[model samples]
Target: MSGISSASGILAARSALLAAAKAALDGQTDIDFYSGWQYPVTQPNWVATTDVHADMDPANIGPRRSQDETITLGVSIGAWLPGHTEDDIVAAFERAFSILNTIQTHIRTEDITLADTVLWCVPGATDSDGAVDEDGSGYQVEIATTFVCQHRVRAA
Candidate 1:
């Protein structure tokens, strides 16, 4: 029998990552000068709502082993602007993500080392909500994406 298993964890140092991302994108900066969209901070689903802080135990009895964990930060971007293409939304997110990495120094973290990345989502549309702009478009072509920030440190 192969007794092997793995565990993960994401110390809830900053559980408000979602809200923070939304706010950040709704700003003006060099990193946010792309995507060709106005700064209204649309789409609230641009942040990750689900994550896991894993810790795996060594299936052996030797000296000792420390558990490993990481903060899987996710982000998504949606647009209600009619006449907009999927590429537009993605470009906006890329712009926002770059800005995020630049100002992420303010956020608190337990682990000193951390990694940043944006997860890609499938290309499609969702149920119509309500037209915000012209074209009478109710649904939003969400350029949803996620980020996994790895870290290992102490909380402030």
Candidate 2:
């Protein structure tokens, strides 16, 4: 039996999200991980990241060693308008929330498969709801999904 490492699981999760988002959203949005671009200004974009602590389980030491892992995938969506008015901010928030919902729905219904490893992914809770920025740049919304991947350590 082969075991899937944490690094591989993270990569696969990211790839699956990017593909799903692009396919569902007509390929008009940008997706990346650990990007340096500023939020709000970079409208119609998503940033993907893995929660280091929330997704890992301690290794089991025994014959047929296996570990239960939960991979938390975060997707942050941002949108902006070039006005300072209250209406403009509200519009921005609505736009960002719309995109966020679209992404979330796609992940929940679509079938995500990792080509390199045998892993299972399911939609999890969403956090960091939409909020208009005080700086008046725009609004930002974030949604997260947990993917449970079962890994078995290969015998040495």
**Using lDDT as the measure, which candidate wins?**
2
Q: Please state the error at residue 15 of candidate 1 in Å.
A: 1.3
Q: Which parts of model 2 have CA positions greater than 4 angstroms off? A: 1-8, 27-54, 58-62, 112-119, 122-156
| Model 2 residue 15 distance off true place after TM-score fit, in angstroms | 2.0
Q: Tens digits of per-residue lDDT for model 2 on 43-104?
A: 44454444532344566544555455555555555555566466876776676667666766
Q: Write the per-residue lDDT of candidate 1 for residues 36-128, one digit (tens) a residue.
A: 234555443233333333332344322334333334443334433333356645544444445445335333332222222111111122122
Let me know the TM-score candidate 1 reaches against the reference structure. 0.37
lDDT of 1 at 78: 44
Error of 1 at 59 (Å): 8.5
Assess every candidate by TM-score: 0.37, 0.60
Which of the numbered candidates is closest to the native, going by highest TM-score?
2
lDDT of 2: 0.52
TM-score for candidate 2: 0.60
